[model samples]
Target: MSQPKDVEADLVFWRRLESQRMEVDFTKMAPEKCMAAMIEPDDVRTVHIQDIRGKETQYNLKLNGFQYVWHDMPELDGVAEQSHVENVVVPKTEALRELSLIIWSRTGATRTVTFAHRVRCLSEDEAMLANNRAPAHSVHSDFTPAGALKNLESVVPDVAEREELLKRRILAINVWRPLKTVQRDPLAVCDWATLNWQEDRVTNRMVLPHGWHELGKYAFRESQGWYYLSEQQPQEALIFTQFDSESEQADEGGMTLPHTAFVVPGTETLPARESIEIKMFAFL
Candidate 1:
């Protein structure tokens, strides 16, 4: 017998370059939604974007200037969707003269998606004085491509430390589905597991299935957003949720038992390395 392939899609994070760094918040929007950030100076030029969901995984990052073009997919197959981009432009003559951005996407339907962002007078006189010198060309020349598919089971950060850090934080694993309904019932079950590392060996924080205990204040929503904040450096618990096919399993308002943390002793009890696969919708 054959099994269905696990659901997973590429979610891309796009950023448009401007004079200064700005924060883009999606907290107020639906959790599953994807967006972009474009900083501008005086307006006149709105950042350009063609798609928020990308057709390909390849990303283009231009040097000399900080401009990013991202491509990812939407979580749901068919539902009314909205993508927003925020801009924070600084006024300076020597900074940057111009900036442009573009985002686009492809759904199963024939409809096309595209948008743009731009900024004017980015390189003014006074701005030039505050501008920082560009980094050494040798550093920029390092040709390292971005966006490589990674194994879902691969350990993140320091697993040993993560186990101990998880004690103080809420740890949940999530998966995204195509949509939310009876048709995708199997995909809706989200299982979160908490773990203790200092007490055990090999690995610390392991995914718990059929077991949801020791979950902290962290909450995971299907259409909301996911976060992981830790007070410890090497070891810390996190909440990794996104608008992916596997993200649905962790959806809120469920009757399932609350998540709890567990610990295993020594390296003998640990599995060599098992890949825990979960489906995600778009890349967020």
Candidate 2:
């Protein structure tokens, strides 16, 4: 028998269309759950079904699925930071079509994040279309609760007393980064609030070294998030911001953000290195 030659296939055909891009970050989902088992329909995000893929596809996530969430630094923490590994759901869509997942983060002062997708083929049994390959990236977006405390204060009445109760009840908060990477950190930034705080318990601070480098004099302030590139090998790195929830009870003991934006080490005027990357997937 003659030996058959191995054929190579074009991987580019499997990409997703750029126009279909949607925000998938975990920070957009409200009443987020963590490390919990799936249960009621409310526990999931209902994704409407469509014939875009062909088959009468009904796409929904299993109960208690894992997800990555983002949010602003806690009211107690000053910098803009991100939270990860939050549980989320894809609401049931009236018409079902295959969905893509992605993770993204920006660095430097300004960033131009771009992604691409392409359709592969249609499935006969499934009666829907399928991508030869999944998109390079997808996000698990968040839905933060708006006016969680404001509404509570309205019911309670006493301004100061209501404020204290709301702050203590705030399990977490989420924030978004509107600008892309540039050559420096944003000097003035605004973070969205979940539970409003009247007191200065939630903070913001910035620090700089003096003289000929103060050895361990890290920035300690003015950082929204943190990043480390394997390409750069330096045992020492600066801590932009830190949140301590010792006084108030927080969700699983921390805060959340949309995504961690990175900044280069050393001088504060250099564009961040772009070696860091995120890969997405859907389990069988």
Most TM-score-accurate candidate: 2
For candidate 1, write residues 1-284 as lDDT tens digits.
12222322112111222311223334443323312221121112111112212221222111111112211223222222222111111111101111111221212211111111211111122221113111110100000011001122132346774444333312121211112111211111122322111111011111223221121111222231111111111111111222122222323321111111111123223322111112121221
- Considering summed lDDT, which 10 consecutive residues are worst modelled in model 1? 139-148
In order of listing, the candidates' clash counts read 62, 67
Overall lDDT per candidate, in order of appearance: 0.19, 0.20
Evaluated against the true structure, the overall lDDT of model 2 is 0.20
TM-score, cand. 2? 0.18
Per-residue lDDT over 217-259 for candidate 2, one digit per residue giving the tens place of the 0 to 100 score:
0111222111211222111111111121221323423322222
lDDT of 1: 0.19
